[model samples]
Target: MKSILTILVFLVTFGSAFSQTGEDKHPLLTDRFIIGAGWYFPTRDIKVEVAGDIEGLEDIDFDETLGLSQGDNTFNFVFFWRFSKNKFWSVRGESFSVGSTRNVILDEEIEWEDITYPVGGEAEVSFGVALYRVFFGRVISSGQKHELGGGLGIHGLNVKASVEGEGFVGDTSAGFERSETEAFLPLPNIGFWYTWAPTDKWAFSANLDWFGIKIDNISGGLWNVSPGVTYQIIRNLGVNLNYEFMNFNADIDGTDFRGSFDLTFSGPSIRVMGNF
Candidate 1:
């Protein structure tokens, strides 16, 4: 937590250290408010390790151990607002979700949350994550057609994992429906962005967001990066295409569960944008 705080202080003051703004800017940067709704196509690689009242569990690969889809199409939304006091200062928010459920025959002995499912039995397995991010930032430097800035933010996650199969119930064989665990992780992060407009109708941008630290009962890192271009359809509207990569790794000791997981999502995206 101490390491995270040290970074918090550094990123919060990032703007004042080298704040600069360009008089000439693109419509996307100068807009007071912008909203976007997009679709993302990404491949996922997930591995989970968990135990209840037990330890030394092995990692379970979602794709190899269980038959879950390795790719998905999902919706993402974004909003940004530049403060009236300083166009160089702004706050942005983003949200997205990815997950799936599948039923398959168990290939090896499985133990999760005190329940055991022997090989050859059928099981239903599911995993999903919903993400939210909000950041406050400033433009540290700018030129006629470009701007650069860094900021601090929080990456909030809602993670759920579950496996259901027949297991012993107090020494008696019984059929079970569901056994699942959910965790909420709110982590702090630091991010930087660059935007350039070569013409009034076309603009290019790239953003990098990352953080790694141990906070209380949770420990690990998060990374999100996107680079794309925008084409203005009209004065108040546009379209954007970007390739984004996101990964999250964490170990948790929480009220509902204790476990660790690593999830990766990366792919291309297309969005419709409104600028004002």
Candidate 2:
């Protein structure tokens, strides 16, 4: 039969040139970069209450006390840039840094004071930054490989408050003064994630994050909630554990002076990750 029809047309032209050279040497979509390192703990408490008419005293009472604690440990850095690699969907750009320590305590008592005006305590150093970030994802399953995500960002803040006592009336040993505040804001974020890939190079991840900042032209506000975990140790390296809750508020007016402040922070964090 004519040599079996020329051996079935040379086996269908060598199987279509080996499936088009394995789809041009394997390509679907790719672009990613990430780098990270972390640890930041911040704690602050402040209270200020002033009741009207200071220069013209009718019923005047003023009270203030502030304490800031930053667990003596700080360092955090992050950078990420990724665009489109549909595990479901993806987009990213991020930058981060945080450091802490600010403590202040002051007390003043008056009614023509038998004598009580002490401002003998001080410490300062606090910082925050988030340039830009926008990310998203979703892939419920890749046969037991899961994923989910959400995002938003933009933030900047700086703080410094220092006051030392025994110098309100006369001269003494511990007398020093400092007060500083710088803020720029527009931050919003949301997150939910779960990932696992127990084989093909190993992976594990978890996340929950909520973030906020409102400056309303200096009627300040900041909020945060965080939970995190990650481990890869290869294929790009990874390690993380984070827990955080933070809130800060402020209102101020100068020239004739006016003030209001509040702060709260909680912690536990450790991180190191890289993917490219």
Candidate 3:
């Protein structure tokens, strides 16, 4: 009887301790905060034509075609705070800002004095900000050590464009300028991400996001799609390699302007991130 009692007591103690330790170490999906930086490069092309005759020149033509091959690099910072994190679902709020400059080349061939004159061109810059994003995701794969998920988000953006130029007409210098126009609108975003952990203290991830906006008042829009990979150097610190493509287009407002204008940009970027 004594032996049986001692064995029963030992079994009960071991079971209780095992259960407690398992509960403490069990995998959990919980809310988290993420902060990161990103770099952006934008290349663009614009085509503008005027519809009406200027200065009594019947069938007037002003063709401004601009192309940007090498773009200016801009920095971006983002914050995402998760409200819920479950095995199969998650919700988050995000904010980010990105900006870049586009080298503009205006190729104007005018028919004047019954002769074709090639007018020189200039460049411009554009920038944008995403004020808020609300996102929802579903986890497709979840294991003791790995997670994979895809999600969609709604975003609000504020974007602006500006132009400055100096060129020639018959060996004379001329200048042109335009103020920045602001576009504010809502956009939809979709993304997928994979997270892996080789050890208890190390984790790595890769993700891609796509979003766009259409501004009716400005007669133009902007779209961006980015893919990036990150390595967690520590629990909350990371570095990333990202590549992105951004497209922009707008119309010239005056009746004197006789053509349509369009632009596009693409490039690779590098960045770093942290979670607090």
Candidate 4:
């Protein structure tokens, strides 16, 4: 699948390099509003450990320990709005969801909260994450074929993890044991974006965001990189091919969860865009 996407992108770039439309600028550079939707294929490495009052707990490597898939695909949506009178400012938003579930026999004893999942028990583990982001930016520099800007943004994340299986607690066996934990993290970030149009119909763009901050009882850091290409199929519609990379780590001392999570998700995405 990756090879196919690579070929597609190469073909688009090859065709656009030699083709030129009469228009002097790309439509995406001038559109007041742009909306896009697509699918995302990601490779994930997620590590988690919950620190409870009970003392002894082990860090879990989701893919290695639980047999979860390292690669998966999901739907994605993005929106852009240039709202100022002179079109020098804009706001952008994007969203996506990631999740995986697996059933495997435990190789070693695992303690989660008050329940102990013993070795040789078939356990079901599932993890899910939902991300929502919005940004406000101003174009500091621009030309007929390029635009550069930076802005402040916020990321809203809701993550949940669960384990269910036959387990034991304090020498007492529970035919069925289940433990689940969920957390909501709101992280603020700053980002920059750049776009270069080689022709009226083809453009190359990239966006980067990063931040390290402590808010309330949550200490977290985040960074994201996205580089893509766009082809204007028509005056009001286009298509996008992009590769996204994200890394986020956080520590919590709250009532819901008292542990840490370090996650990395990277993938390629293709979307359809409409302008207004």
Collision pairs in model 3 = 43-264, 43-265, 47-261, 49-258, 49-259, 50-257, 50-258, 50-259, 51-258
Residues 1-276, candidate 1: write the lDDT tens digits. Answer: 999999999987874443333343568878889999989999888888886644666877887798888777999999999985768899999999989999989998777766677789899999899999999999899877788999999999888888888875445666775778888888799999999886667789999999998978879899999999998878899999999999999998877768888988999999999999
List candidate 1 stretches off by more than 4 Å: 1-24, 53-55, 168-174
Q: Going through the candidates in order, what is the number of backbone clashes in each?
A: 0, 2, 9, 0
Point to the candidate with the largest TM-score.
4
- What's the CA error at residue 117 for candidate 3, in Å? 12
Candidate 3 lDDT, 1-276, residue by residue in tens: 999999999999876643422221122222266666676664434333332333443322111233332345666666555454443666656454544456555465433222223445554534333445566878888665567888987666554444445533446655443424455545577877776644333344555556544444335444556655555555567676666565544443433333333445566666666664
| Candidate 1: RMSD to truth | 11.6
Alpha-carbon lDDT, every model: 0.86, 0.44, 0.51, 0.89
Worst 10 residues of 3 by lDDT: 22-31
Which structure among the candidates has the greatest lDDT?
Answer: 4
Model 4 misplacement above 4 A: 1-20, 54-56
TM-score per candidate: 0.86, 0.28, 0.53, 0.90
TM-score of 1: 0.86
Clashes of 4: 0
Model 4 alpha-carbon miss at residue 33, Å: 0.9
* Candidate 2 lDDT over residue span 30-148, tens digit each: 21666677775644343332222334222111112233334545565655554545545554444434433444444432211111234443333233332333446444444434344
